[model samples]
Target: MKFSATKSTLVYALQIVQKAVSPRNPVPTLSGILFKTGADQLTVSATDLDLTIECTVPVTVHEPGNIVLPARYITELARRLPDVPILIETLTAGSAATISYGQSQSNIHGFPADQYPELPELPEAPALLISQGKLKEVIRQVIFAASTDETRPVFTGALLEIRDGALTLVATDTHRLAWCRLPVQADEIISIIVPGKTFTEMLKITGNSEEEDVTVYVSQSHVFFVTSVMQISSRVIAGKFPPYQQVIPREFSTRIKAVTRELLEATERASLLITEGMPVVHFNLEKDACVLSVHTEAGWIREEMDLQVEGEPLQISFNSRYLCDALRAINSNEVLINMTGPLSAAVIRCPENTQYLSLLLPAQPKPARSE
Candidate 1:
């Protein structure tokens, strides 16, 4: 292969595909990036057998061929190279390649193109069209609650369900759950479990504007996300998502409406004061206000935020970290808190929009140490 591309354009494509490069996989080509030169563009691809990323950029192609070079070396070299066109050429017979820049040149041995794994072929199904901005927002709202424990495979990813015209995404870690719903036009009912890691990477490539649409293609085993210049494909997690509807609280004993930012700030401060053993923040919902406090060996925290209170008064304790995460995800000025009891599942939602909500299983904090 032989190609020359501007440093800026070349570095961008390399950096985008480098995320899928295997760190130390047994397959040599998996750790490298496959570079294919075409008429006037360079197509870069990398895969770790599970997730694959490919990006294309305009470049000057002297010869149309393919090679696989170390992702780490190529990306780092392109990033540090001077602002000039860089050239890469491979030998006719051997796996030898040379990178040329102004007054400098370096040689790197590459793997034969045949050794690289092939990208998955998309099924001939209708593509689901969705606004890139809406998808990005929904993924951020729920993906953080996904379980990181790999032992329980179902809980490690988010449940993606599309029925009628509503698209719902739900994620849970046993202790807490977060869900969001969006409306879209769909011809078929679709339900699948998408790995949270894949959605996290999708956020990086998808544009934040609602004008652009992302075409989603689902095969029997793999899901593909395609944009104008990029593509991301991942294997679907093969498991049934839990029945998440049973856990959402429909009744409440006490309801509090407070400013989202105020509560988030208080929870962050309380989290800092909490110790390793006592990771709880006690919420004392009194008349007309909510008081947040946490008692630890280091000190004590007591913050009061005023809001509209309804129903009965109650006190509940929850993991400070969990509470902070839920609060930060809410994209609203005013948040509604519905408490069933001290030990029951407490719900948090935006007052204006009912599409998103989070549930937290209250925690028992250790008692205050001796003064």
Candidate 2:
């Protein structure tokens, strides 16, 4: 295989696909990137059995062929290369390639192209086109809540539901739940569980372009995300996700509306007082303000923030980290907290947007204190 591409273009493609290369891959070829040269472009692909990433860059091809090179070696080399065109040529009989730019050149040994596993074929079903910005935003808001524990497979993935011409993504670690919905144009209802790690990698390649549309294709076992420059295919997690609809509370006895930033800041400060065995932050909801307090053997902190309260007064305790996670995911200026009582789970939502909701389970009861 032989191709000439600009250092910047080749480096970008290599970096994107390298995310799919597993560091501890047992299969030798799985740690390498497959490079295929065409008449006008070079395709770079990497896979780790479950996820695959492929990207193409414009290049001048002297010969149309393919080879698999070490992902780390090639990516690092290209990144450090001078800003000039890079020429890559592979021997016809051996898995050796020479990469040269300017006066620098290096010969690297690689695995044969046939040794690499083939990427999953794209599904023939009609694709769902959605804004890249919206998809990335929804993933960012919910992926953080997915359980990192691999034992419970369902909680380790995010539930993707498409119904009524809308899409919703829900994720939870059994302690806190994040849900985000977006309206889209689609015909059929679809539901699947996607590994959170896949979405985390997708965020890196989607970039910050909001105008671009991402085409989504789902097969029987794999899901594909296609954009102008790159494509990602991941195996769907197999299991039934928890019925998240029943998890969200429908009614509340007390509602507090407060500035999102202020509440987040107060919780962050209060969390500093938390210790190893204790992580609860107390919330005292009054008619005109909400007070967040944390008391531990080390110290005690109380912060009062103004808020608009309705329904009734209430008090509750929650994990400070859970509160911070939900608050950081919210982008609105004002957040609405709906509580049925001091013991029930609290529902947090944006006052201006009804499509997003976060449910946080209350912590263990704190000792009673004088008012």
Candidate 3:
């Protein structure tokens, strides 16, 4: 394959596709980025069995061919090259590629493009168009709650549910859960469990183009996200996501409204006192104020913040990090905390926005002291 393209354009495309390449992959070709040159464009692709990223850039193609170059070496070399036109040509009977820009030239060995696994084809179905901004927001709100442990495969992915005219994304690690809902137009109802890593990479690719629309194509086993110049495909985790609706509390015995920033700050402060394991922050809600305290072998901290309390007073304990994660995910200035009891899960929501909900399981409270 022989192609000529500006260094910046080539670098950008390489950056997008390299996310799918991992050095630890057992398949040697999976560690390489496939370069396919057509009439006026070059397609770069990388895959790691579960996820694939492909990017296309305009290039001057002198000879039309395909080859797979080492992803790490090519990406690094392209990034370091000057912002000038780059000439790339395959050598050694397509076993290697030589990159030249100005006076600098480098040759790298590669595998035949035919040996690379083929990217899954999109099914013949209507694609769903979604606002990039809204998609990114929902992902940021829930992806953090996805469990990193691979034992319970379902917990390692986020559930995307589409029904009626709304779409909801839910993720949980058993300790906490995040749910975000938005209005969307779809002809048929669909549900899929997308691996957490997919969202992480998608967030980076979406960038700040809120006005742009991302086309979503769902197949039996894979999901595709297509943009103007890039396409990302990921294998859907095969299993049933936990029934999250049952875990959400239907009612609460106590409700407290407080400044979102203030609660986050208090939790962060109390976390410092916790030395080992998860930090537990004790909450004591009264008529007009909420008291947060933490006691650890190293030290103890107590903080008080004014709150608009309703219903009965209550005391609850939660992992400080969990509370912080929920609070940070909220975009509103104020937040509402609904508690059923000391042991029940506490629901956190933004008063201004009802579309997002976070549930945090309470930590066990310390026993009372003997007289």
Candidate 4:
């Protein structure tokens, strides 16, 4: 295969597709990237069985052919090449690839293109087109909460539910949950568990702008995302997510509305005084003010912030990290905290929007002071 492509363009495409290349690939061929040069374009593809990424860039092809070269070497070469056009010619008959730039020459050992595994064929089905910006927003709001541990296979992936005219992305790591909704129009209502790692890669490639709509292909075992010149596919995780709806508190005896940034700052300051074994932060809620207190053998801290409260007085203990994460996720200025009892989970939400809810499990009880 003979092709000439701009160094900058070739480097961009290589960087994008390398997200799927795994160093510990089981198959030797999987470690290399498949390069196919057609009449007008050159394509590079990489896959690790579970996930695949492919990108195409404009190129001048003198001969239409294909080859498989080491992904790592190609990416490094392209990145370091001089700011000029690059010429690549592969001789499959000899299993060699020649890379050239200004006053430079390099030869790389490669495998026949046929040795690479064929990418999965996208089936003809109704696809959903949604703005890349909105899709990325939903992912940012929830992907962080996905369980990093693989013990619970289901929680390691994000639950994508398409119903009516909306798409909901939900993720949880048992301790905290994140949910985001987006407006979408699809012919069919579907639900699938997509691996969080795959979704994150897709987000990285999708970018943040809504310049174009991203096409999503869904099946029982696989999900594919197609952009203008890039495509990503991943194997779906097969399992039912936990019943997340039931865990959110519905009613509360005490409610408080406070500035999100203030609450987050207070929690961060108090968390410093907490120790490793002990992860609890005390919340002393009164009529119109809230006090966050943390104590350790080394020192103690107390933070008081005023808020709008319209319920009975209450004091609760909770994991400082959970509250801080939830507060940081809220985009609005004022946040609402709904507490039912000292031992119950406290529901956190934005006062203006009811679409998002965060639940924090209470910490173990602390010793009471003798009056």
Error of 1 at 221 (Å): 0.9
lDDT, candidate 4, at 130: 86
Residues 1-371, model 4: lDDT tens digits: 89898988898888888999986777877888889987699989999888998888889998888888888898998899998778999865847899998888899998898899878877678569887777776787677778889888999999998898988888888877888777788878889998999978876774325767789998767888888888788888988999898887889999989988988998889998776775778988888878888877768888988788769899899888777878887878999889998988788887777666677778876786432
CA RMSD, predictions in order: 1.8, 1.7, 1.8, 2.4
After TM-score superposition, the amount by which residue 76's alpha carbon in candidate 2 deviates from its true location, in angstroms, is 0.8
The lDDT for every candidate, in the order shown, is 0.86, 0.88, 0.89, 0.84
Q: Model 2 scores what on Cα lDDT?
A: 0.88
* Model 3, runs deviating above 4 Å: 206-208, 367-371
Off by over 4 Å in 2: 206-208, 368-371
Q: Which is the leading candidate under lDDT? A: 3
Any runs in candidate 1 off by more than 4 Å, and if so which?
A: 206-210, 365-371
- Residues 102-140, candidate 2: write the lDDT tens digits: 998999899889988978999787558998988999998
| Model 3, C-alpha of 305: deviation from truth (Å) | 0.9
Worst 10 contiguous positions by lDDT, candidate 4: 202-211
Ranked by lDDT, top first: 3, 2, 1, 4
